[model samples]
Target: MNTTPASSPPAPVAALVQMTSGIDPDANLAAIDRAMGEAAAGGASMAFLPEMSLLLDRDRARSAPHIAREADSPWPAALQALAQKHGLWLHSGSIPLLADDGERRVNRSHVIAADGSIRARYDKIHMFDVTLPSGENWTESSAYAGGEALTVVETPLGKMGLSVCYDLRFPELYRAMVDRGATLIAIPAAFTVSTGEAHWHVLMRARAIETGCHIVAAAQSGTHADGRETYGHSVAVDPWGIVLADAGCGAAAGDGGYRLSFAPVASAAVDRARQAIPLARSRANRRITL
Candidate 1:
């Protein structure tokens, strides 16, 4: 007879939102409100949104008016109100906010508790400064200053680590999150179609397998008003490197309209995966030659 104790508690349901946000914050907020309602109705305790959930305007001159300090931005307050109304925890993918310097902006993500209080915030550490083979060039550093520290917070879902798009390529960040006792990580992204098709799935699975943590990557999808096309495959991966759900890409996803997908996040799954492999212990004992 097989007799083994449960590793942890039962799983919680998480809702991942895939959006194609435009320049209008009001329209975007309306979409998010509807999604939050749906997420609550679907039994999701927490909802994870894609990067730039509030606004996604590439034109600096046009987006300038909308991007302001956190205190001045109405979007954050609206999101908090939505969370409170739905009685659901919210992982606001990323919002563009003017930095303290008042000249540059920061891609910031926030964790809002169920009661409408802000729990934690994380600025995207990595800037998208690459020139794609398709002749698409993005110099995020020119407008958005990179973050200096990592952020992790406690929630009903689990001890959560936060990161934004472009940060996914750096495995060291995920490793550090695991070292900090994070059982789940949220990587909100707005991936280009070309890059998403090539690396999104592999990186998502790799991060999950390496850290033994549930990975929820809410993403932006479809063509945006700014004339950029993003790959729309919002995905959730388990600690065992298994895909729990994937909101498909292209026209099937309403060309980046509102799409909500649900996934299970169980602490027991994390514990079981870590126990089976014990990578953390092995790494702890490894010699560093730097």
Candidate 2:
């Protein structure tokens, strides 16, 4: 997934941190810090860490206190400090932040400035409450409150819209995001191998095709220590629906480690060029009323 960054203005260079996170928050932060440092050294303007960046527990009870909140929270502050230290924009994937109920948490995402400021926070609107074909049931609603808002934040790159993993399946969400002027979208995820194999790439490409925006999906690859396996081919899809880079994740890839990881930094110059000549805009509009 390596590509040379042609000479241009201060374009956005986004590095993705892929992980098979264990139950420990500190360990996960340490891994993220290391990867972020590498990204900065590699000349990245912005870096995105995958979802469940803080804590991933098959058991919900043990993961509640670790849910992040506020500017001073360790995870948020840690990313802010890292961004400030490296002078880069940090898009931290959704963390479970504490909410009104002591037991329930808000699935949260944070956008931090290079100067150590919290720019925007997006709570994951779509919940992963489902029953997969493998009979793996996920009831995210029991532990989280659904966000009743569409979050699109202005970044140095462009209008970046926020949506967590499961939301990728719903094109209407991405359509609404683009209708509001989103030039780029982020779908940070911890997609299961079952669904990831079946619908991961197809759904993502469809969203990109429908929205006319670049999709940068930083992912959780490989098997988790909790016995949950994720589909780990983290990808960056162009507005034209071409996969610019697919970070590899195989069975022998470090055995739940970050081996086949890639720092696929895309250029704004090229992205703008794609948006300048979108085929979706010129086509006849079809009206579908339910």
- Full-model lDDT for every candidate: 0.92, 0.75
Q: 177-241 in candidate 1: lDDT tens per residue?
A: 98899999999999999999899999999999999999999999888988999998999999999
In candidate 1, stretches whose alpha carbon ends up further than 4 angstroms from where it belongs are: 1-10, 251-256, 287-290
Q: Which stretches of candidate 2 lie over 4 Å from their true place?
A: 1-11, 68-72, 101-103, 250-290
Candidate 2 lDDT over residue span 1-290, tens digit each: 75987765554656766777778888787777777777788877677777887777877767655664454357777778878877888888878777655556787888888898888888888888899789899998987887778989888657889999988878888878877888788999999889988888988887776677778888887777677888877787777677866776633443334432333334453356446765445543546544
Model 1 clash tally?
Answer: 0
Residue 252 in model 2: lDDT: 44
Top TM-score prediction, candidate number: 1
Candidate RMSDs in order: 2.6, 4.9
lDDT of 1: 0.92
